[model samples]
Target: MNKAPLITKMLPRKNSLRNGGELDTKQLLAALMAFRRGDFSARLPEDWTGVAGKIADTFNDVIRTNQRMTQELGRIVRVVGKEGRITQRAALSDVSESWGDAIGCINVLIEDLLRPTSEMARVIGAVAKGNLSETMASEIEGQPLKGEFLRTAKTVN
Candidate 1:
């Protein structure tokens, strides 16, 4: 009367570590290839017990961390570079290792980029206010102006 159980019992066990049902490795290979193609959204199953499972866990962790960093970087760049909101900084507070170094360098670079702009604004603003005595330094933070920036600084000063 009921053939459901009979048909189900006819199939082989799947790789429980991944799909947990079908033993076919096509899914695994496809997921791996997707990861190789710059897709970090797919995560391998962590159900395996041996070395493979451990490797999968490490891979997922790395992907998660890198994804977060990349997202934060995109947000920071959009806000600061595209929107002209230079005060915005990367919100990754608990970062460490090379990631931390990268974030720190980017923040420092923002400040450096702002310095000349701020100096110009101050000089120009003072001039607009009729003070007529505002002058821009030849260099900011020991870095001399060059090319167009130097020319603009001279003109503004």
Candidate 2:
């Protein structure tokens, strides 16, 4: 089978815009196309003025934030795999509203994941010393532990 080139697939049917006030879309298109190809470094020209410039800057910021998150995730994997601890956290600044929520969610997930492991370790240490009575306390006021942690705590007790 034969296939068209990737860049050709991204090109518009016509080169010129009919409206005079239309912003030159080539840079934005190219950046988006590069991003679709997994190039997180792709960025539109910030030198563009007015709405175009704002759009480009926002796009760039999103790409940079994603890149930072990716890097931080890698670091988290390495640290947790080697040191068995999530000693570092991802910090995303000046991101769009959606990205802010996503970052917050990721942080919360990491903390939730670590909490069970730490609690289990504490319980297991006590068990190792023949103190089988040690169990995870449902001490978080309104929030009682659920899921696997709760099951493990029951088994341990």
Candidate 3:
């Protein structure tokens, strides 16, 4: 079996490479390989028109969105780690719609974690002023605080 025929059939014609309207397969392959190696900066030439241009644009958009998400997540981790609480909520304006659930979950986690701590601080402050009857404001009927937080509130009370 002559492998030359099979190899020739798999490759684009030489004329196709020089065609001004066609995508440069070599460049596209390099960009894709770079992306696969975790280099999000790789991008196909935007000058290529038609579907090729659209595909490149879409890939670039995905890379940019992913980079933004990674940076934002790092910022969140640093803020929470250094300050011991989430100071600012993650910005959702530029984030993709697929991340909406994750953003909402993070916000909820921040609120849940801080709410009990804030209530404890307030109760402790009130007690420190000789008002021993003070208790956590979160000790309501339907929205009772949970587990360790409830026990903390009881101890403070």
Task: Give the top-scoring candidate (lDDT).
Answer: 1
What overall lDDT, based on C-alpha atoms, would model 1 receive against the true structure? 0.78
Model 1 misplacement above 4 A? 1-33
Query: What are the runs in model 3 whose C-alpha is more than 4 Å off?
Result: 1-38, 84-87, 137-142
- By TM-score rank, best first, the candidates go 1, 2, 3
How does each model score on lDDT? 0.78, 0.72, 0.74
Clashes of each: 3, 0, 0
**TM-score of every model?**
0.71, 0.66, 0.64
- Summed over model 3, clashes come to 0
Residue by residue across 1-157, what tens digits does model 1's lDDT show? 9999998776444544443333335655776688788687967787755545665677777778778888998998899999999889876766688989988998998887788889999999999999889898889879998776788899987
Per-residue error (Å), model 1, residue 33: 4.1
Please give, for residues 1-36, the per-residue lDDT of candidate 2 as tens digits. 355787677544454333322346776788898988
- In angstroms, the error of model 3 at 128 is 2.5
Q: How accurate is candidate 3 locally (lDDT)?
A: 0.74
Question: Among all windows of ten consecutive residues in candidate 3, which has the lowest summed lDDT?
Answer: 12-21
lDDT of 3 by residue, 1-157 (tens): 7799998886657525333446677787898888788787888777876655666688788777767777777778778756776567766566656787778888777778777888888888988898988777646436788899888877877
**Positional deviation of 48 in candidate 2, in angstroms?**
4.4
Locate the minimum summed-lDDT window of 10 residues in model 2. Answer: 13-22
Ranking according to lDDT, highest score first: 1, 3, 2
